[model samples]
Structures are given as C-alpha cells and as structure tokens.
Target: MADEATFTQLKDKVVEVRHYIHQHPELSDQEFETTKYITNYLTKLGYRIITPEKLNTGVIAEIGQGKPVVGLRSDIDALPIKEATGLPYASVNDGVMHACGHDFHITSLLGAAEVLAQEKDSLKGTIRLVFQPAEETHVGAQEVDAAGGADGIDAIIGFHNKPDLGVGEIGLLPGGLMAAVDQFKVTFKGIGTHAAMPQFGKDPIIALSGTVNAIQTIVSRNENPQKTAVVSITHIEGGSTWNVLPEEAWFEGTVRTFDGEARKTAKKRFYEIVNGQAASYGVDVEIEWIEGPDVVDNDPQLTKWVVDETSKHLTVVKPEPSNAGEDFAYFSQKIPSVFAFVGSHGNSDWHHSDLRLDDEGLIPGVKWYYYNAKRLLAELGKE
Candidate 1:
C-alpha cells in the first residue's frame, strides 16, 4: 500500500490533469494537442521519447536501462460526442468528448510514469510508456507496432476503465478478453419510379429490409449455437422524398466474434445472404467489407500472474468476455501481454456523453501500473 501523503498527492495530480484533458478532447488521428501535452510532460520527467515516423499524433517514451523491456500503454483518443456532463471542465471543443474515460487512462499512466521516473536508477530494465492514438478507429496499435513500438519489448500491460465495476476493483480474464471487430456497408441499387406505381420500379428499400432481416440468421442459424457472434445493422439510409422510390439504398453495421473461424463464417454468410436477397428483389448490390482487429486474447501465464499480484492490492474479479473491439489485440498478438479492466465507478457506460468517473479510481490504477511494471521488470531481469 502507498503512504497516505504520496497517495493524496498522486490523486490530486491525476484529477487536475484529467480535467485539463477532458476539457480539450481530441478525436482519433487528430490528437496533435494531446500528443504535445504528453510529450512535454514526459520530457519533464527526464524520459527518452520516440515519435513514430508514420504518424505525428502518438507518443512513446522510455526510462531505465538494459535488457528485458516492459511496456505500459494508454489510448489517447476521444469520440465524436458532444459534452453533456455539464461539469466545470466539460469539453470546450464542440462535438468531441472523452466519453470512454481515456482521460483517466492517460492520467493514471502519467502518474505511474512520475513515480517510476524517481526510481529510474534503481530499476532493472527499460520501461516503455506507449500513448496510443486512433484506437476508436482500430488502427493505432497496428501503426505503432509497424513503427517498431513493440520491437524489443518482452512483455506489455494495459487496462481499460470499466464503469460496471467499483473503484479498487479490476476485471481479469486470461483468454479472449475482447472480441474481434468487423464492419460491412451494403448498397442496393434499383430502378427509381413513382412511389404510387409499384410495378414501375424495383424497390431497393424493400431489398435492404429483407437483407437486414435475413442477416440476423447468420447469428441464429448459420453460426454455431455454442459460440458467440453478433451482427447488428446500426445505420440505414435511402430515398429523398416519400413520393419517389430512390435509385439506391445502403445499410451499414458491424460483426463481432471471438474465434477466427466464427468470424469467417459470419462474414461469408453475410455476403451470401445479401447477394441472395438482392437477386430475389431484382436489384444490383455492392458490398464493402472492412476488416478490423482480432480478438484481445490475454497471455494466459501473464494474466494469471496479474490476477495473483493484483488481487493482493485490489479487488480482482473474473469478468465475462467483452464483445467490444480493441486494437490492443494487435499488440497482444505480437508479444506477451496482459490487459485488465480497472474500475472507474461511473453511472454511465463508455461512449456516452453523460459518462462520469470517480477520481478515487486513480488510487488503485496508478498503483497497479507502477507496481506491476516494477515487478514485471524485476521478474524479466531474472530470466
């Protein structure tokens, strides 16, 4: 346990920094100001910084020396949500808010970095701090890895803030902590005619509706009943006015699954169903499939170690696997990694404008990052 004075000071600093970041939120791939702020802060802590050449929006810094590199990461992107919290430090930038508690992630990692910096000389191996960007779009981790972010790192640790859990509690799962994400956009093109005349035109909207309903079968009938998969059509648009049938209609949505075979099966069935529906409706069809990150499978051994050590300091829970997509899956694929969920004690869930998080969560969060990295470095040094 941290001393009261050190804990209080760290908590105060995290809150102040979080509020400043919350007010000036930046969207993915456009986190220039956020990058600058993080760079300046890490530089003052006397860490060596590395800015990836492929992108100018993310920051990576390192401290300590010698072998057995360990990484701690935090995402640094905001959503396109308007501020609804109405707090004093609510987003000043319109149409952008830290609805996902990324501000908390950044502050916690920064707090850990501050304490770790003070113990740099005594530390055994290199500790890399990764401030990843464009996570919401699911490409940041890939870009970072391509730029050699995880090149020499032996192991990495990351965490997300879970509103469902309370402060001082964390969620840990060994395999498949989060699902893979995939998206599809389908357009049905048909002849346009007067709405009153049914036979005069083939209605694309009808085809779209039929396709949407049929695609649900991908999960219910086509996919294995025991496996988990989701197909949700979240967006649909067609027609200019009620009087005329539009020439084209389009619908877009996402698919999530844990197993690679399940993901492939769902996508194949989706294409077939949409094409079959289009043929039956006598409409031309075009499908755009956007493949995203794979499942966030935590390293079993590393995760077990996390559960054992973290349980000693905080309340550890075995959380159910999440269907949400995370780009950190890319990093996990490359090296040994453990991703946990730290409790934020919020009433609203992630990506909601009304989301709130207690500052007290930082107490456990910073300690986890600091102590976990320190111990991991020591353990790696032995091997």
Candidate 2:
C-alpha cells in the first residue's frame, strides 16, 4: 500500500492522464498516438519495451526481473462514438470517443507503472504491462499474443469499469465472466424490379428479411434451453428507393455465447439457415464469417486469490456474468488470469455517447492495478 501523500499525488496524475486521453481519443487498430504516449511514459520510467511486429499499435513494457513474471494488460483504443457528455475535456477527435472508459484503463495502468518504477530494484520477479489496441474490433489480444507478449508470463490480470457498481467496489466472477463473440455478414443478390411488379423479379429484401428471422432461431430454438446465447442483427441495408427492389441486399450481425457447445451450434446453424433462406427465395447469397474472442473464463484459483487479497484493500462483490465480449479472453486462454470489473459509478453504461464516469473511480483503479501487481508478484515469488 502507498502512503497518503504518495497515493494523493498518484491519483492526481491518473486523472490528468485520463482527461488527456479522453480528449485525444483514437479508434481501434489506429491507436498510433496512444501507443506513442504510452511508450514515451514507460521509457521514461526505465522499463524495457517490447515492440510487436505484426501489430502497428499497442505497447508492452516491463520492470523488475527474474522468475514468476506477472502480466497486467489494459486496452487503449476508443470507439467511433461522438462525445455527448459535454465535459470540459470532451473528445476533440470528431467521431471518436472513449465511451468504454479506456481512458481510465490507460491512466490507471500507467499510474501503477509510475509507482512500481520507484521500487523496481526491491521488487520480486518481473511485472509486464501491456497497453493493447483494437480491443473494440476483438483482434488486439490475439495480435499481442501472437507477437509473444504473453511469453514468460506466469499469470495475468485485467479489469473493465462497471458503471452499475459504486466507486470503491470491485466485481468478480470465477468462471465464464464474459461471452464469446462471433460476427457474420450476408449478401443476397437478385434481379431489380419495380415494387408494383413483385412477380417480375426475385426480391433480395425478402431473402434478407427471411435470413434475419431464421438466424434468431439459432439462439432461441437451436441452442439448448439450459444454455445462454444471443443472436443480434445489428444492421441491414438494401434498396435505395421504395418503389424499386434492390439488386443486392446485405446484413451484418454478432453472436454471443457462454457455452462452447452453444457457440458452435449457433455458427453451424447460422450458415445453414442463411443459405436455406436464400435458396428458397431464389437469390444468390454470399457469407462472411469472422471469429472473434472466446468466452472470458477466469481461472478459479487465480480469481479466488485476487478476491481474497484485494478484499483487504477494496470492496469485492460477486456480480452476474456479462454477455459483453472481451478480447482479454485470448490471454486468459493461454495463462492463468483473472479479469475484474471496477466500479466507475458512471451515469450511463459502456459504449454510450452520454456516459459520464466519476473521476473518483480513477483513484481506486490506480490502487487496484498497483496493489494487484504487487500481491501477484509476491505470491508467485513464494512458489
């Protein structure tokens, strides 16, 4: 634990950094400036930096040395939402905003780095910090993992801000905390004809509409009743004019599931249903399936350790599982890891343009990151 003066100074710095990041937000896979800012700060702290070749963005830095390396990760990308909070430091990057509280993520992790650096020589084992990019697109963790960012890491930990919980609270769930995410895009092609002459041509809209209804069954009907799953058709685009049927129609959506069997069933049925509907409508169909992050399954032992230890410093609560997808699932798949939900006490939930996060959450966030890293390093060192 840090002294009051030190904690106060660290908290001030965290808020400063958070507001700076909130104002100059960048989108996923395009976080060049964010990466540079993180790299510069870590470099000044005398941490060893690892540059990933496959990824254009993201930063990995480390302090201390020896065995039992503990990894701490934070996503540094913003969403494509326009700011509506009207804060003094609202986003200046026109269509981009850190609506997901990533500004808080980046700041708290950096705060941990600053505090840890002062005691780097006395620390036991290494502490690796990963400032990941493209989490919104669900590719950053895989990219970082492929680039060996998780190499030599014994255990890892991460967190997301929960607007529902009050400040000073932390939510923990041992198994299957977040759902798996998969995406698909379908295109239907048919002859264009006047709306009045429906019999003259095959309508792609009919095929698109049918496919949308069919995919819903993939969750409600195909998936086992005991399991959890969701199939959402986010957007559909087809005709430009009301009178003429469009020659082509396309729709894209996402699938979320917590069970592996449920996830597999959903994908298999999605393809079969889409193709079946297109054939029935006499329209040509094209399908594109993209595999996103898997379910964020927390290691039971690691989660227990985190809760038992952090409860001494912060309030820990058991919360319901989230259907939201997290790319940190990739790291959890490879190493023993625990993902926490820190209370931000925001006015609105994540990804909302009007979301307003209380800055008081920033102090607890910095404490969570700094304390968790120290405790993990200490425990792992014992083994």
Candidate 2 lDDT by residue in tens digits, 77-141: 99999999999999999999999999988998998899889899988999999999999988899
Tell me the whole-model lDDT of each prediction, alpha carbons only. 0.91, 0.90
TM-score per candidate, in order?
A: 0.95, 0.93
Per-residue lDDT tens digits of candidate 1, residues 243-320? 999999999999999998899999889988999999999999999999999999899888877787788778999888
**True-structure lDDT of candidate 2:** 0.90
